[model samples]
Target: MAGKQALNIVKIKKMKQDANPITVITAYDYPSAKLAEEAGIDMILVGDSLGNVVLGYDSTVPVTLDDMVYHSRAVARGAEHTFIVTDLPFMTYHGSLDETFRNVRRLMQEGHAHAVKMEGGAEIAPTVHSIVQAGVPVLGHIGLTPQSVNQIGGYRIQGKDEKDARRLIEDAKALERAGVFAIVLELVTEEVSAAISAEISIPTIGIGAGRGCDGQVLVFHDVLKYTSDYREKRFVKTYANIGEQIRNGISEYVNEVKTRAFPAEVHVFAAEEGVIDQLYGKGKAESES
Candidate 1:
């Protein structure tokens, strides 16, 4: 009810061409997706960050294709009008082309996602190409891919130097050629992100990559401060303190219950006058009254 219309590949590409900044948020469940839709977010990503935020995992490397599909289905049901992109979790796309296609098919058919996002650079372009050719839209990701965090030696900013910057640029261009409608640049240096945005025709959705991108994305929980123990990140701008509010509200409920202040007269149902007397002994009820 909040958004204008669902965005498609053509419209998304047009936004980049028109220099319109697209907005995206990660929503892993029904209520989160509903909130994102009601807020009129342009796109909803069923990100594998759910491993950390939703599933209590240490990193996204532990997330699987099934986890993505389950969450994507919930998000799709809630945000029916918004474009939904589901992540191909670790190892789902690293196999043979046929295996990758099967994974992509499950995300599209069972997950009900409009598109599937894969991490890596030019190295994975051919796989992206094959998915696109199979009639599935692909979103590319680069710069600190979480699925390969261990390989990359942890979540470090990428493209700080000349050679790394060039590689990112090449990755972006190759993704474009491979037919990805957009690419996500995560934790890349601002200069390199801007350069990639300028160099490529497709929109670049930035997380920590800076303002030069055609669009931006952040996790729903991160934006709303929904995770009580989540450490503050440099790139995140929390707009609300819902976690504290929840804690306070629940604490109040507990105090009220302990004090017998809740379930007062207004919260109870009255029995007929004689019914109570009959339930207890009549003489006892009369004497008590």
Candidate 2:
């Protein structure tokens, strides 16, 4: 088991400054987090995308603060060195500053996350500042924030036109000003993403936003092909079809059971013939009595 020393934010900052692209992946449970740590991944996000990938919800809005805390704690326990960033689920930070502080504190103290990520731009900058002042690191998220999917109309690419692109650039700058360690650019145009990466002093972590970012992030389930029901997205590249392998392995077990070939002599326990005969005699005596 790995020890519980979290990755330093300074290292990630230096990586961005040195132009060394960072790598981040989402892990929802202990097994996934442990595997990511063993693989030496740079960061692990206990994203609310867990709702879609793990909890069977159609959208992230259905996720709650309690849900994030539960999964974040599991990931934190498994990941020792890798930096852990957990999402503040929808509506957790959008209300009063006291409410935001309470929830963010719970995520850090209870969930054991190194950092917390929240959506929105300038509108939430004050909340971001408050959290940072309270000694919690904040990772700002803009450009196709999933929590805003209903308001934005759907899961479409952001920063397409000049007006939207300009606003995105401003949002990134605002978040950087608000003291966010990094920003997640999701479903933005490549040109816009590259521009923001160039403009921002902090790192830009991209998801479905092309390769020009300071780092790239993807869900573990998508990378490992963990399920056959998962929808393939343009940005997702399936590395290993573990789902198919699992299916085949289970089928083999089923066939072996049907054929009575699984539990061979080597799989059974043995006793002396005299002991077996004594057991049989005891049973006969009891029945006769």
Candidate 3:
């Protein structure tokens, strides 16, 4: 399989015009990052989704900048070849441009992310611009943003009606104007998703948005069946049912352990008499203990 392409805002900018689809996936830990990189994932988002998936939180709103830093650093270590984008958790980008820049720097300088992603439109244009000016690339997220879950209500499709669609299109434009590398469209109608993709100068990476998007992103847990929350969304096409497979495999192991079928010689190591004697007079006391 093709490995991850060299990832940066410049390549993504080119992809916007070239219409090449980018692939993004969230990875919170080392093993996931290593496998995602090896599987040729184009980008690894150290998204605040980890607050829910890894930490068992109900929403990402509670994830702090420190939390993002810790997870981003871990993902960065395991994904040397993949471009890693760390999310600016909920309140990290608020109040002042200076504050935003400081948080972005911390995530980049300490967390080692190539870029940062934030959710907003015109309201956040200034912050996005300031971050880019400060030398950190920004990725925009629009339409059904999770960070605004409380304000916007629950998770649902966005940009369906005419007003909402227009707003989404405008949001994409605004993000492009703010000099974002790409914009993520979440839970949007296919028509609106397509329209935004066509209107934007930056690549549109979709989640619940449809096939016309320039790229697609999914939480790692949702993709790999580690998500134990709700069932799959309409847009999610499961590539594997690893959950059931893992469950069955573990169940078999449990049954085997109960029946004493696990330690069937191949699973344990044995030593010859003379070699054992050399190591211990009869056997090591540590072993006996």
Q: Residues 18-129, candidate 1, lDDT per residue (tens digit)?
A: 9899999999999999988988899999999999999999999899889999999999999999999999999998889889988988999999999999999889988899
Models 1 onward score TM values of 0.95, 0.93, 0.90
> Better model by TM-score, 1 or 2?
1
Mark the regions of model 1 whose C-alpha exceeds 4 Å error after superposition: 271-289
Clashing pairs in 1: none
**Local error of candidate 2 at residue 118 (angstroms):** 0.4
lDDT values, one for every candidate: 0.93, 0.91, 0.87
Return the top candidate by lDDT.
1
Instruction: Please estimate how well model 3 matches the true structure, expressed as its whole-model Cα lDDT.
Output: 0.87
Ranked by lDDT, the better of candidates 1 and 2 is: 1
Candidate 3 lDDT, tens digit per residue, 105-181?
A: 99999999999999999889888988888788898999988899999989878987999998988888988888898
Q: Report the error of model 1 at residue 20, Å.
A: 1.1
TM-score of 3: 0.90
